[model samples]
Target chain A: MQQFKTLKDLPEQDYFTGGSSACAGCGPSMGLKLALKVLGPETIIVNASGCMTLLPLYPNTPLKASWIHNAIENASSTAAGARHGLDMLGNKDMNVVVYAGDGATYDIGLASLSAVAAKNERIIYICYNNQSFGNTGFQWSTATPYGSETKTTPRGKNNPTGTTAVNKDMVKIMGAHRVYAATASLAYPVDFLNKLSRAKERDGFSYIELLGACTAGWNYDPRLTIRISKLAVRCGMWPMYEIENGILTLNKDFSELKPIDEFLKLQGRYRALPQDGVDRLQVLINEHWAELKEYNGQRYV
Target chain B: MKQTLVTGNEAAAWGARLVRPNYIPTFPITPQTECIETLARWSADGELPGTYFDRMESEHSVMSAAVGAAAVGARVFTASSSQGLLLMHEVLYIAAGMRLPIVMATISRGLSAPVTLWSDHNDFLDQRDSGWLMFHAENNQEVLDMMLQAYRIAEDPRVLLPAMVNMDGYVLSFTDEPITIPSPEMVEEFLPEYNPDHTIAKGRPVTVGPPVLDEYTIFRAQNHVAARNALEVMEEVMDDFDRIFDRRYHLVDEFMLDDAELVLVTQGSMSTTAKAAIMEMREEEGIKVGLLRLRVIRPWPAKAIAEALKGAKAVAVIDRNLAPGRGGIMFPEIVETLYHLDRRPLVSSFVVGLGGNPQTEHKVKEITRKLIDDLETGRPRVEWNDL
Candidate 1:
């Protein structure tokens, strides 16, 4: 695995190029681009049915690496097959990575993902989570944070809280499988690339759920994609952490978390959030942050 | 060649072992569990040196892994029955659409509403439109032989499609019968190393099963054409199988069809019972009865079927599967195939032996007598024999 300590140390050759229908400053697309720098061209990107599935409009694909789109809930199982197949064919050096969405990873494809992780197969799995089912016009998913408003969870007269369900902790769920699990942000390229390198080096399943801050779904300025992503990490909403061999390590430590209001105010998805909802969300974030801090450098899950 | 007493599940496992599939992703299901168990035992004992026998969480993942493995140019094999086959239904089409040559053993069982773990064609026949080259076997020997032929035909460049070799559950899967397990060297001579030019490997960048717009119809047409192409590939594979192992097979198996005026169209293990009844009728009752067993269901052997039943005055289509309001599934297919012939046989529909109902010789003779009556009346009947 090639170590890239800084942005300048990263490889210059790009495998994911221009020419798709991806939204401007598409965080998932950027995550994939940086992932290819770590994975290189000798990789097979197993994609599930989601927004990125529409990346390759017929006869045209931005990815130089091989891509396999199996179905809505089978990117992990499909990647498992590709990894085993390549290994049996004596081409064991090539990478078989899955690039799926939150809907695929946290919801539909969760069983497939857990089974593969339990087996400790040598494959890198990346969940490009944009918070909601962003492809389907911002429908709420289990990954959707509380107080956020997706189309399905609209702030109406009956329900003012909008998204009431607590967000699923994907990192803890994956770490419980005894495989390397981490969280990445599009704002931090070097950290994500370094985690990608670590996942590449492991001869077992490694999961990295990268926060893909959506421009279209979140109704944010395309230019604020990075700012929103950075705010997510700094505000303790989306922590930068990794769990290796049951030990959790905080990648970005802070003296105090920034206010969650700035992160919520930037996205239209949270514009309808009331004062009480905002306070509730802040309490939830603080509670989660406390747990992570207590478990830091300790055996997690 | 070694003649040994084995179950149909063992026969399938032997076929997979002889062909030396590099990957065998499996999940346990009734009637199909022993097949994977045998492979798992071999993998554990180090008897299968190059094989990776992986036990998956479900049949869906088993097939998904198979597609992944086959897409990367590895010979892949798996087995399932009833609901297990249904669970893998979605990926089966994807496997065919991707043109991955995966050979799977489908041990047929009755579908559930009220579940039965016995032999039936519903589970197998339900996958008729999945774009797989379908082969149903009469006995354990044919079960093993078709597995060898399935790989040969599927891997052919013209075909490049997945194949499902099915045998009835319990009767074939658990019951023991004498079969000649072909030598590994013979299978090696017959099936070449799987080296697909379309797979994904190092330094070879290609997209598979990508989203297509107008080209969706084109890919579907190609799927249909490739399956149709397997009709020719079957002949070549049959010839090679005969030359290598001296076991001759055909797209449609015929028994006493030359001088017979009464014919019974059957499939799977029930054909053996039907053939026995036909012989007793020929000797005692003096009824000139024969049987035409449908081996290949997909890429339906329409020509062979028409020619086989051309001379018959009446044909009884005995189906071990039912289509609810639509009588027997194969009854329509047979009638459709014979429609263009100059002299079509009087084909009657008979749905029987569902959910492993014992397909006794008594029922066979009764069906033959019904066919005789239908011929005399010159009017066909659609009836369920169990009633």
Candidate 2:
């Protein structure tokens, strides 16, 4: 057992170490670091094929904790197995957390994760939504925003296509399972950590949607990763909220929604949008915010 | 020293009860449901302690919840058949890939569309490459015994892979026979409480299921190799079981194969009929005949099959399931196992008893008798379509 010096005084040896192949200032890396810090040494993680997987399993990497690499679509199931292994060994005090990308969580892994969460199995599932399949070179994902210029969605289209399909409402979808579900952001460390800590204390399945930034794929200045993250929440593009036992609570009250362009302009993935395209994107964002507002819940902002 | 008539399904449940896993996530399905119901009843009666009986919504969820519970370092158990196994197809690969030693009982049933709740090898046969140690039980005794042995084999450090113990639906699963049930205390002595060397439990933390690239598939492959190596441990565990319970089973059981010209290789409940047919041919016709019952299918027990049939002039593999255009599913594996070997015997493939069609004593006799005639005629058909 190691001693904790400060909250960030993490193991001297990181749970997710440096030298990972992740581009500089990847929010998923920092999010993982903070998650391990709070989860302590008594946690096991299940990761999927995304930036998190690429970096962690990169050659000659220094890893402080034990890990299993599962398929992108089955992290929750894999983590569930690890959790059961822990219980078999009489380690009921352990935390089993599965970290997946937006593609894995919102699309392929959606059904299995939903089933496990609905059963309220004791586990933590964190969907690190980088908005696209960054490991595969910025392909548009189900979580990709409208008018975002991804490898597939090269030019932000004014006309609706399949690419314009609404980003899956995973947080609410998971919430509907009556398990603990929350949307968090890497930029909001205090709020993110608080939710993560609370998730750890829960006895059943809990999920936190992490608004992670992919520095390379998103074509952003790595240093502005935190800024991009905060802009997303402030703009109502990525709301900070939690749902516990079917009751939703806003982590950041959206009293005055910021323009979505501020968040869009930070990443090159959304740079192809023309003026009218930005207006359409904002309209969509506004419509989504209206629904968030009408959702009968206590505002925490 | 008491004997009670037990079906393969009952024995599976009895076997699970002996191990006393921490959780059993199960959804009721034909043949396989009894395996979990017995465990649930035991859990309710205090016969099994500290075990969670999760009645999940679907087979997918059953395996999913078991995976989650097992992820937290819990010894988990579940049972399913046919469509249920197919429902868990995705997670089955994940479990093996993640190196979670989750033990599940799969009662073999034909796959669906024209779904029938009858005995067939197609269920587990289709999943042969999913990287799980597949054990086919030939009788109620082996079904019960394999359930106990599967844990030791799957949990072995060399083979930290999930395993499926398969019994033919209705045939062995529903059929009752006298099975010696080991005392829980005795089983605890035989297979101690599962203490995983690597688990993401409370004090000791680890990350399971990280991502791997195509090149890093070697890591996953190595895990599979490790699972294959666990077959040796199965032999040791069975030996230990024999010493304690006085029943014997070869990882691949062979009967009267020495100096034989023809050998019939089969698995699951059909092997019993095959053995009877081989005996009848040997006694009445004076034909040199024998039967090789495959107990372990995942690792394929190629070495055992090869060694047992070494001196035989010809070997015929009787499969209850087809691989479609290719003929018997098990035949190709057996052929591949012996393909590179020096001095291999003539191997014939025959597909029979699909979609729960009974492989009666007559079918086995007809197949083996034909193989004998072909050996004598010197023109044995290596592949035959299902009759």
On the 0 to 100 scale, the lDDT of residue B108 in model 1 is 94
lDDT of 1 at B224: 93
Model 1 stretches astray by more than 4 angstroms: none
Stretches > 4 Å off in candidate 2 = A1-17, A58-63, A84-88, A156-162, A296-301, B27-31, B55-73, B86-99, B112-116, B157-160, B201-203, B207-232, B282-288, B332-346, B382-386
DockQ of each: 0.82, 0.37
Report the lDDT tens digits of candidate 2 across residue range A76-171.
Answer: 766665565566566677677787889989887777787678778889898889888878888888898777767787752344332465677888
Model 2 CAPRI quality: acceptable
Give the per-residue lDDT of model 1 (tens digit) for B111-174. Answer: 9989899988988888999999999998999999999999999999999999999999988999
RMSD of each: 1.0, 4.0
Model 2, position B370: C-alpha lDDT score: 75
DockQ of 2: 0.37
Each model's TM-score, in the order given? 0.99, 0.88
Native contact fraction of candidate 1?
0.77
